[model samples]
Target chain A: DTAVSQTPKYLVTQMGNDKSIKCEQNLGHDTMYWYKQDSKKFLKIMFSYNNKELIINETVPNRFSPKSPDKAHLNLHINSLELGDSAVYFCASSQDLRNYGYTFGSGTRLTVV
Target chain B: TQLLEQSPQFLSIQEGENLTVYCNSSSVFSSLQWYRQEPGEGPVLLVTVVTGGEVKKLKRLTFQFGDARKDSSLHITAAQPGDTGLYLCAGDVTGQGGKLIFGQGTELSVKP
Candidate 1:
């Protein structure tokens, strides 16, 4: 049983298109987050939600939006994707935003042409 | 923004060899964590150290937190091919629920 799972393990699309990645966690965690790993393998946090409320929004662009309908699910929607968006997107969950470690999804590889 | 700097961005070693990865920061953290990630997967937490000068061991891996709470180190003993992956360290500054700052990460390749 996967603790956290993200859909569309692989996504390949063209520029100017919009896309969404879905994530779900069964760890009963109250906080969920979206992270991006660039080609250099640098993991950076993009957004975080606590109990369906936005709490942390890194310096990500407005084109990148995250929505949490509930405590168990958090989805990311990208508008007008560009080549720079090519990277691995990961979904993570924690007991709370202050937890030291978080459970993470396998990750979604997004490639924009 | 809190920053964690990791040294030796890349490491390659033969099976049975030993190595250590270091994560440092000028800021003091309430807690520090270590994670390992395989290709195509998100990072998995290995251990979390909260107290200064604390040390934790997991099988052949040993982790240590600096006394000042500003740095940490991960040492692997007799590393194997299965241990190859990207090692990352994250610092938690929030006392209760805050943000975590991650280091650049160390890519380790253990060849058999």
Candidate 2:
């Protein structure tokens, strides 16, 4: 069984459109995170949720929002997507990450035309 | 703000060769982790080193955390084609809860 899974492995949308990516972890971890990997393969943290509480919000664009319905699920919603928003989005979960490594899901590749 | 800098962003080597990739940062980290990501897939944790100057070995691979806890290195002995992937180094900021700052990543290509 997959410890973490994300839907819509590939997405292509026209510019100015909105899209959403869903993620869920079955590991029962208390924390979830969203990261974006740019064309240069540089990974950056966008948001971090612990027990469905917002925490560690990086200086990401306001158009990008993260919603954690619960500790097991964290979804990302993008509004007025732009070409620069096209990147691989990854979901990860961990318990007390300072003492552990995160378990990541297969990434969702977003393409904005 | 914290940042991790990875060296030798791209490395291509023969199957039997040995290589080392470095991740450096000026900020101290509570722990360091190494992850390997394949094409179109998420990264899988290879190892995590918490103590400074700690060394851990997994099969043909070895990881070392600098004494200052601001740098780390991954060394592979006799790399194989299957080892070709993107290697990422992430650090856990001392004050950032459950936050990991990642490096730019090192793309390694091992040819048989």
Candidate 3:
């Protein structure tokens, strides 16, 4: 059984197109996060939500926004997607903000042409 | 920004070789974790070291948390082809939440 899952394992779209990546956690975690992995394999935190409330938002561009419809789901929506946005986006969830390890999804690889 | 410095961004060795990957930080962390990610897949947690100077072993892998909690290392023995993947180290800075500050990552390739 998958603890966390994300939709569209691979996404390809044209530059300036709008797209979204959906994530869900079956572990009933209260905190969810989005991380972007660049071509260099550098992983950077983008956003975090605690109990459906925005908590940590890094210096990411406004074009990248994260929405948590519920405690179990966090979605990443990009407006006017650019070629630089092409990277692997990962979704993770934790029981709480209490230092517990996170459970991550398989990841969604987006390619903006 | 709290940064973790990972050395030897790329590693290539033959099977049966031994290697060590490091993650260093100027800022001390409450806890740290290591993960292994394959192509087209997300990262899978390998282990978490909380106490300073703690060491843990899993099969052919060994992990060490620096006495100052500012660095960590992963040593793999008898590297296998299955070990080929991206290794990432993430630090739990405040120890209160899942706010993970990750290193650039080390890509290891094991030749058969």
Candidate 4:
């Protein structure tokens, strides 16, 4: 079974359109994170949730919002996406907030035109 | 801002050749981790080094953490085609609220 799975492996949308990416983890981890990888392959943390509580919120734009309905699911919703939103997004989970045994999903490739 | 600087943004090597990748930072870290990412998949953890001056080996890959806990290195011996991927180093900065600061990453291409 896939430990961490992300829906819509690939997404293509137009500018000003809104989209959402879903992430779920079966690892029973307490902490989950959303990271964005740019064209240069630089990974940056966008948001993090620990047991359904917002823990880390980076300097991302207001258009990006993360919602965690439960401890095992964390979803990212982008409002009025722009061309610069084109990149790969990854979902990851760890047993604790300290980043022990971190596991990442395959990732979703978002292309905003 | 706490940042981990990875050197040699790109590396190409022939099979059986050995190479080393370095990750450095001025800020101290509580722990450090190494991850390898392929073409389409997310990164997979290779190893994690916590204590200062700690060294761990997995098969032909050896990882070392600096004594100051501010830097780390990854050494691969007898490189293979399967070793081709982007190597990333992340550190847990003190008082950052559990956020892992990542390095720029090193892309390795091993030709057989």
Clashes of each: 1, 0, 2, 0
TM-score of chain B of each: 0.96, 0.98, 0.97, 0.97
lDDT of 2 by residue, B1-112 (tens): 6889998999999999999999999999999999999999999999999999999999999999999999999999999999999999999887686889899999999999
Q: Against the true structure, what is each candidate's TM-score?
A: 0.96, 0.97, 0.95, 0.98
Error of 3 at A35 (Å): 0.4
Which lDDT values do the candidates have, in the order given? 0.92, 0.93, 0.92, 0.93
For B60-106, candidate 1 gives per-residue lDDT tens digits of 99999999999999999999999999999999886534567889999
The better-scoring model by DockQ among 2 and 3 is 2
Candidate 4 overall lDDT versus native: 0.93
| Ranked by DockQ, top first | 2, 4, 3, 1
Write the number of the candidate with greater DockQ, choosing between 1 and 2: 2
- On TM-score, the leading prediction is 4
* Candidate 4 lDDT for residue B52: 100
Candidate 4 ranges beyond 4 A from true positions: none
Give per-residue CA lDDT, model 4, range A4-113, as digits (tens). 99989999999999999999999899999999999999999999899999998999998999999999999999999999999999999989887755799999999999
Clashing pairs in 1: A98-B97
Lowest lDDT sum, 10 consecutive residues, model 3 chain B, at B90-99
State the lDDT of candidate 3 residue by residue for B1-112, as single tens digits: 7999998799999999999999999999988999999888889999989999999999999999999999999999999999999999999968434689999899999999
